[model samples]
Target: MTLSVRSRPSALAMVSALVLSLAACGGTTKESVRTQAPAPAASGAASASANPDAPIKEGLKLAFLPKQINNPYETIVDEAGIEAAKEFKAEAKEVGPSDASASSQVSYINTLAQQGQDAILIAANDPNAVCGPLRQARSKGIKVVAYDSDTSKDCRDIFINQASSEDVGRSQVRLLSELIGGEGEIAILSATANATNQNTWIEFMQDELKKPEHAKMKLVKIAYGDDDDQKSFQQTQGLLQAYPNLKGIISPTTVGVSAAARYISGSKYKGKVTLTGLGTPNQMRKFVKDGTVSKFALWNPKDLGYLASYAAAALVSGQISGGEGEKFTAGKLGERTIGAGGEIILGPPFTFDKSNIDEYDF
Candidate 1:
C-alpha cells in the first residue's frame, strides 16, 4: 500500500487560471508563446483548405467524440477538455455513443465535420473503424486529435498519449507479479478487442511475461469485456472459473479493472486473486481500502484531456504541424515538445493504493 516513489499533483490543479489566462492572452515571456491569427475560411465555416500555412484562430469551436458518452471515466476526461477549451478561449462540445462499438464514433465524427467544428478530439474505439470518417473530417480542416485511445496515426493530426505504451504495459504486469509473489497463473481482462492502446499494452504485457524473471508466471487467458461494467464483471467471474488456478488479473482498462475488483471483493477469491491495472482513484479507492485491490496505475485523465485539447487548439491554430520536434504551449502543463509519431506523452503513470489514493479524486 506504500509507494517509495513521490507522487505529483493531480491535473485538477495542475495549472492556475491566471497562467491559462496569460497563455490565452498571448503571453510569450517564458515557456508560453503567442499564437498566430487564423486564416480566412473558404466557406462560412473554418475550412481545411483555408491555407495550410495560415495560423489557427482563437474562439474556434471544438467537438469531443469520446469512445462512449455517459461513461463516468469519459465524462470526467471530456470535462477537462471543456475546461481547457474555456481557458484557451474556445468553444467545446462532447458527443458520442452510449455503447462502445468500433463504428459507434463514425456518425458523431461526420456530424462534427458537417457542423463546421474547428477541431475534433476523440478517444477512438477502434483504430481503423473511424479512420475514413476522420480523414473526411480532416479534409474539411477540422483538426483531429486522439486522446486516451487513438485511431491510426495518419487519421489524426496528433495523439495525446496518457503514458508510453511500454510503461503502461510493463507496469501492470510488474505490479501483479509482485502482488502474486512473482509466479502464478494470471489472466487479462481487457477493453475492446480492437482498441489500439489496449491491444498495444496487452502485447507489451505478453512480451514482459516472457522475460526470465517472469518465467514462473503463466498467462492463462485474455478476456475482453468491451469496457462494459457488467460485462467485465461477468468476464472476471468467467476467468476465475475457466482458469481455476488463476492467481491474479491485470485489467488494462479502467472499466475492466474496477469491475474485476468489484467481483473479487465479494467473492471467495477476494484476497486469493490479486487485481491490478489502469484505474482512477475515485473508482478504485474503496477497493483499495477494503483490501480487494492492492494497487493500480493511471495517468491523470484530466491532464490527458487538458493536453489533448491544447494539442487540438495548437493544431487548429497552426502553431505546430504535427511533426516530430514541434513545440507548443499546453497552458498549465507549460511547454510540450512533440515526439516521434506525432504523439505527446502526458506523463508517467501514477501508482495508487491505500496510502496515495486519497490524494487523487478524478
Candidate 2:
C-alpha cells in the first residue's frame, strides 16, 4: 500500500518566485541561483548584501550509486532512469562500488558531496553503515535519495521502494505454495544477509505460511548468495543435495532466481522442483516456457528506474519532500504517491506465466 502526503501546492509558488527573481535580474546566470556567504570587500570597498534563499536551477550533476557496479538489474534500472531524468534537463550518472561494500560506498559518497553534487541516490549495502556519511553530505546542502535499499531515516530526503514489504513477501510464498501443492519442503534464495527488503519479505512470507490457511506448506532453509549467480547456483545445488525430497526453492534476488532456473534446468530435479522468485521476464522467459520455472514475480525494472529518476527530479525541483501524500508524475506510470513511512509504491507484485509471458520483453 502507498500513501500520499497531503501537501498544498504552495511549493509551486516557490518555483514561481525563483523564476521571477531571474526575470528581475535582467539576464539570469549560474551565479544568480547560488547562495553565497557575505564576505568583506577588499581594501576600502563596501560589502554587498546576500540573497540566501535563491533557488538553484534544475541542471544538477545528480548521480545514483548501486550496491554492485556491473549487475544487469541496476544497469537496466539506471538506463530507464536516465531517459526520465532527461525530460527535466537533469544529468543522471551511474556510479558504485566494484563490489557491494559499505566502505567503498562511503568513500564515493564523501567524494561526491565534497565535489558538490546537488543530489545522490544510492542503494545501501549495509542499512546503517553509511548513514553517518550520507547525513554529513545532507548537512553540506547536497540532497540524498535512498533507492532500492534505504539508509537511516534521517540520512535520506526520501526513499523510492518498488513495493511494500508485505506485498512482495506474501506474494512470493503464495506463488511458491501454489506450484508446490501448498505442502512441501521449500528453501529461500535471498540476497545478502544485510538486505532490508529481502529480510522484510522473508519475514512476512514466514508469517503468512503459518496462517493455517497455508498449513501444509513448510519452509526448510534460507541461503544467502550475496546476489551472486554462481553462489546462488551452488546454494541451489546444496539445497537439492541436502534435501532429497525438497519440492521448491524461492529466490528473491534476480541473480538468485536466474541461477536457480539454470541449475534446476540442467540438474536431475528439473520439472520436479519448482522455482519462484523475483526475476526479469527476459532472463527467465525460456525457463517459464519450458516449465523449469512455473511462475515468478517482479515489478517492471525499467519503470522502477524511471520512477526513481522522476522522483529525484521532483525533489530537486522542490516539488515534494519527505512528507506524506505527495504525488508526482512518473511518465508511463502516471501519478505515484509517497505512502506511509515515506515510500512510493509503483504498484503491487505482478506474476508472469505462459499466457502473458510473450507480451512483455522486460
Candidate 3:
C-alpha cells in the first residue's frame, strides 16, 4: 500500500512563526518563548567529511536498540531496519532491555560501543539517561541515529522521527475531541514520563487544548503507565475511578493505547468514554470494531525503520553528514532530507478507523 509523505516546516521556521504570531497578539511571555525554542543542534561528531557519491559500505555492522525488545511496535520498526540493512549487504541486529526504563539502554549501548559496531540506532527511553553512553559511542567513531523517541541533540548523529512532533501531539487531541463530541474531562494515558517523544507530543497536546476551538475540553489528568501492559490497564482503571465524569482518554503510546482499550472494553466505560491516540491497526482493530475506540493515528512503523536503517548506512558510508540540507536515498522510500536539529521526518501520521484499519496489518 502506498502512503502519502509530506515535509514539515523546520523547527526554526515553526518557532519563528509562532513567535511572530504571539508577538502580534501581545502575548510574547517568557514561558511561551522558552516553550517555543528549538532544541539544540546535533553534535559536530556527525560533521565528518561528506561524500554524497560514496556507495553504502558492505559488511558494516549496525545495531538497533529500541526502548523495549518486546514492544510489537518497535519490533516492526527494527525488523524493517534489518531488511533495509540486507539491501546494502550490512549485518544488522536488534537488542534492548525487556523493560522500557530510563537507564536500561545504557548498558546495551556500552556493549555495542565495545563491540565496535559501525552504527548504533536507538529509540531512547529517556533523553538524558542514555546520553553518556551515546557520547562514548560517538567518541569511538560509531554513528548514532535516534529514531521513534529522541535523545538530546548532542547525543546522536541524526534522528529519524516518525512525523512532526507537534502534529502528532496536537492531532491526538483533535481526534479525541471529535470522538467525545468536543467536551468533557479527558485524561492522557502516556508512556514513561521520561520518554522524549511521548513528552514532546504531550506538550503539543496540551497546547492544542488551549486553543479556543478546544476550550470545552478539560484535561483532568496525565497518567503514566510506564509502557507496561498491566500497568497501563491499571492506570486506565484508576483514571476512571479518580474522575467518574471523564469523557475521553488520549493514549499516544502503542502499549498504553492498546492496554487502555482493553480495560475500557471490559468496563462500564466502554461506550461512555471515548478513546483515541496512536496505535497499531492489528492491536486496535478489534477495539474499533467493538466501538471501544473511534479513531487514532500513527505513521507506518516499517517505513520508519527502513528510513532509519538507510540513514545510518549513509552516515556510516560518509554519504552525508547529519547537517541541515543534506540528502540521502532510503532504499524503497526514496530521498530523505536532513532537517534542522538533524531530524528526518517520515511523514504526516494517518488516522485509522474501522473504514481503513483493515488495510494495515502492523
lDDT top scorer: 3
Question: On residues 41-133, what C-alpha lDDT tens digit does candidate 2 reach at each position?
Answer: 111221122112223346766787888877777777777777777777777777777676556688878777666666778878777888878
What's the lDDT for candidate 1? 0.78
Put the candidates in TM-score order, highest first: 3, 1, 2
How far residue 240's Cα lies from its native spot in candidate 3, in Å, is 0.6
Candidate RMSDs in order: 8.4, 11.6, 11.2
Kindly indicate the candidate among 1 and 2 with the higher TM-score: 1
TM-scores of all predicted structures: 0.86, 0.83, 0.88
lDDT of 1 at 238: 97
Q: What C-alpha lDDT, on a 0 to 100 scale, does residue 127 get in candidate 2?
A: 73
Error of 1 at 278 (Å): 0.8
- Please give the TM-score that candidate 3 achieves against the real structure: 0.88
Q: Which stretches of candidate 3 lie over 4 Å from their true place?
A: 1-48
